[model samples]
Target: MLEGIRVLACGARDAVRLCATLLERAGAAVERTASDSADYDVILVSSDFDDANVVARWKTSGSHMVCDITATGPQDSRAGRRWSDAQIQAMSGLMDTTGFAHGAPVRIGVPLTEISAALYAAAAIAAAVRVKRMRGIVQNIDVTLSGCAASALTTFLPAAFARRAVGRLGNRHPACAPWNAYRTRDGWILICTGTEEQWRKLKQEARVPQLDDARFASLAERVRHVDELDALVESWTTTLTTDDCTRICESIGVAAGPIVGVRDLADEPNFRMRHAQAARAMKAHGVDADTYRDVSIFETSALSDALPVAKRAVPCERGANAAPLAGVKVIEIGQYTTAPLVGKHLAALGAQVVKIEPPGGEAARAWSPGQGGTSYFFALNNTDKETIALDLKQESARAYLRTLLKDADVLVENLRPGALAKLGFTREALGAINPRLVYCSISGFGMTSAYPSRPAFDTVIQAMGGLMDLTRADGAPVKIGASGADILGGQAALFAILARLAAREENAGAFIEISMQDVAAWCALFAAGNNSARGQALACLDGHIWMEREVSDAERAQCSALPKAVAAVKLAGATPVMRVDELLQDGDFLADVLSAARDANGAFWPVLKAPYRLTKTPACVRAAPGAPQAVRLAPPAPARAPVPEDRPA
Candidate 1:
């Protein structure tokens, strides 16, 4: 979609190279140039690249420049200190939340922060391009690895705000029972179930009478007795092989998959199928897909009659009243993480996002409590949205959605592959309805999949996508503490939509499909290629610190004699590991990464600030939706006039 755009990637860091790779896969002409003699459409400068004069020249020449600040705030207490991804994760509480409850904080096995920052940077570049086209202004964007780390704490922050301890839970989910990797006869298989019905179904399928007891009845009760609950589940799983356990769970519609390592992606059916589809698509467009790096994740296509040229206009200053997407309208039919997170970002970028859920509300709304008894998981993903419950099974609701699509600029959903298409809202149907709507689908697998009926969750995707395999705790495969696959998939979906929207003047009615499994596989590339090792926790005089490199006896002795902060600072490559409670006490960290938003009952709670920082037409988060309001849907305009835009000051 970025056919003629020229991107100058000038750094040796993995994040910079990954960002350049993403842009190139999107059809940009990328060059690694350090000199500022020639101007380019986009410039990405990593924090390690110290060339102020060259960067300034590119900025003056009206290029869309992005500087990779390692963190949202100061990387360290020391002035002008730079941090690696491990150090940033240490300070940001990502490390502390992983690993076992009894063990020290351990780093995630992959380069998660670097991958996240690259995704954010690429999306920021696309957003800048869109703003330049719409308002004729150049942008200077700032992206931070810490911002990405902080965004992963969306659900954990609520407990932190309530003064509840947010610590490591190993592979177990804090809010759900039977949501960990259970040992099968041959290997381990991950099973994740959130609702009571799924738990009942699992119990019936496994013939575990103990699981049906009153002690394991309700969601809260099951969590309260998770130890026993897990023991009962394991008893049944250990009687069968890993494949048998997966088949049993899948047969009953419970989310389950095998825990694999990075080396297994080549043989994974879903991963191979996704890439095969990407290769076919690229070859049809007369491009050699194998030549492009990271083809699985960077599947950016307009999917229309012809590719449209991205618009270029005179570089003028943005008006004080202008927002990047002030006139944009979005329809989000999403449940948990991926698509709802995209809608939240679109709303933050000044789009009017109307979230359509089932009559009983989305699944996340019933998860865990955050502020004023509202589901914190739902609140974080649905901020700044206007919500309505529609029974889409009814013809009237589907007809109303059709009417809403006629004036909407974007439609995002993460339902099963053919759920919406089965309801007559296919891409062709959407194109005929508006002929200008950008339809984006974020699914566990692509719309065309080898296993169409398989149920997927974040844990399932992590297991199948190779992330869980690479992420180990105490020599056993463990899922990331946060929903890594969901987060990456959401960011990637946003990137595709923003990239397409940048050229929407001509490339209307685009279809963007994102697979969570494929996105996870792409993020695992760095770790898989390098055989990346996980960081370990080291004991200090006062507390423990984390280090990715092996510590010598002398270094360990030195750290043992000093406090965690002092040791981390004095050591060559150590970072202070901070828990959520410790970070909540940090004023600077809180101020830089979080903002207060009201919950459903008008009570304040913390939410992540926009991940990307743009100088011109910056993205902003308005207040979170407060209190339940009766929303009445209006019929479509008789003449199909354009949707009215709402601009907020």
Candidate 2:
């Protein structure tokens, strides 16, 4: 396959290396460039490197077909009047996983799919060159990471399009109930018995003859009795080492494997065999055989030996070819968390973000302190941005905001639904003020009427979205420890804004609306069908305790009705919330509870309710040196002051 084609590979460390490796394998002359130089027949650029200026500069000479390998879509500036089929195909594939999942879709994991796209792009360029030699049109391609990730998830799309929900199950597969990791004597082992035959084999291997009983025979029956079956399996597993269990399961022809700990797979004979075969393939090419072997130390031979070598691409240097968004100015008109966070991300990426806070400052300013008076909220989300106090209600402030809008490229806000319009800052008004501006309106629900006016805190949204419902296997709803909804929504808003910016052809100012509720619903539905298929109770306190809250008297009274051993207790008036920290400190209590719950036929103990208490205290109020201070409630003046004032008059 040795050809007369030339390939120019420009990508971040790993992506660049993969492009070069693939092209070299195809027997094409590969030219590595720190900068885009030489009139090659094919040019490959990294997607992670967002230096649009460099891309623009390279496009000028445009002798060869161009393909981007980055996770992001190409800039609007890169678009041209004419493009080839090869270029269009490459661009279509590149836009894969570059957007937000719930937020702006990001290239998760090792960007393995991006590598695939880069290879595809490289192939397209080579084809384009062959066409150009006979015919005469230079092709330009736009590749995006979002599109790549989306394509990778295409198999799941059938379910997604069917409105089936998907989510991170940690290590559990939805279809198989007992197909999960279980604690063993020494370590954990993943037990996957997807087929009925495998399930039968696994039960027999475990020596649990009771599993053969009609009540727990078939896959459906086993799943129905999963709780009891799991207990029996765990009882046997905890007595044997992971190796012992694995060997036993393997002999019985069951799909079972030990969870790999922090151990080198290179030492394993199976891993060594696979590595040797992979090395031979790598050596056939001009690439260093050892490049692929080093990462083999982490591979499990149970999978294929076609593992790609880890790329050692250098991190993007600061001020490297001018920041992608160096001249981009963003006007942030939001408070609390979601909208402000989007601006924070933009600011981090070198955008001039001007935070417009309320006259009394944002409500988050009064949030709990860390080191200084600065709340963790402000520090975490508002970093790398300038804050300015402005009350939109005031004509002076509104006029000032209008002035700011005139020069701004984007406006981000997350007031309650209809609040923005009520303030006369509607999309039409903003578009009229600055037709080129990108306006992002973040709301609890969408701008639409479904739940436009419903109040949506992170906790409330989680509850309403069925997340809380699904989390509690026992039917008790619980909010996620982190404010997942808000953060993910913020990320989604950012991605949406970027997409709008890239495809801003209409120029009437792109109006982007992101709903926190919608994101939560999406997440809920993603995993809902699979979870529902399992048909398990929604509430079961069998997992790790993520948080602890003090139990109320009413809750305590309710728990008192249970057996004494399983009854919930209040620890010094604070509900006995079983937190990991507390469990570690009071091992005796943990052991006691474990014994009690185990003996009581698997009854769960109720812990404290809320993780943290929200209390108000006057003494805690203080003012920062430069920022506004809290207003104090003064004590009543002495009665004598009235008499003194009367005498003075």
Query: What's the count of clashing pairs in each model shown?
Result: 0, 44
- Model 1, global lDDT: 0.76
Instruction: Name the Cα RMSD for model 1.
Output: 8.1
Candidate number with greatest lDDT: 1
Q: For residues 1-649, could you state the per-residue lDDT of candidate 1 as single tens digits?
A: 7777788888555678788887776777899864557557787776444565655665666645554545554343432355677777788888888777787777787778888888888887887777766666787877777778888877677677767778788888887888999999998899999777888889988888787799987888999998899999999999999988888888888889988665555556776677765435433542221222534574544434444433223222356557666778899999878998899988888888999988767766665555454677677788889888787877767888888887888899999999998999877677777776788988887887877889888888988887887777777887788888899999999888877776624665678889988888777756656544456789887668988787899988898899998998888677788877787778766677778787555777667787678887778876675433334565544677688899897
Question: What is candidate 2's lDDT per residue for 1-649, written digit by digit as tens?
Answer: 2256677776553445555654564456887764334557666665345465776666666565656655434332223222221122222221122211222111111223333344334433433343343234566654544333322322222233223343323334434656555679986665666577777667766787766678676666776776687778888889999878867866665545544321222232332343455334434542232333232111101111122222212112234233334466899877766786677656644567888888777866655432234444454456556777876776667777888898787888888878877888876677667766777877755666343334445544444344444443222223333344565566557655543332212334456666665555434433332221121101113211111234456654545454322432322221122212222234332222111111122322121111001111000111111243232223434566444344553
Q: Give each prediction's root-mean-square deviation over alpha carbons.
A: 8.1, 26.1
Give the TM-score (vs. native) of candidate 1: 0.88
**Candidates' TM-scores?**
0.88, 0.38
Candidate 2 stretches with Cα past 4 Å from truth are 1-320, 504-506, 529-649
Lowest lDDT 10-mer window, candidate 2? 610-619
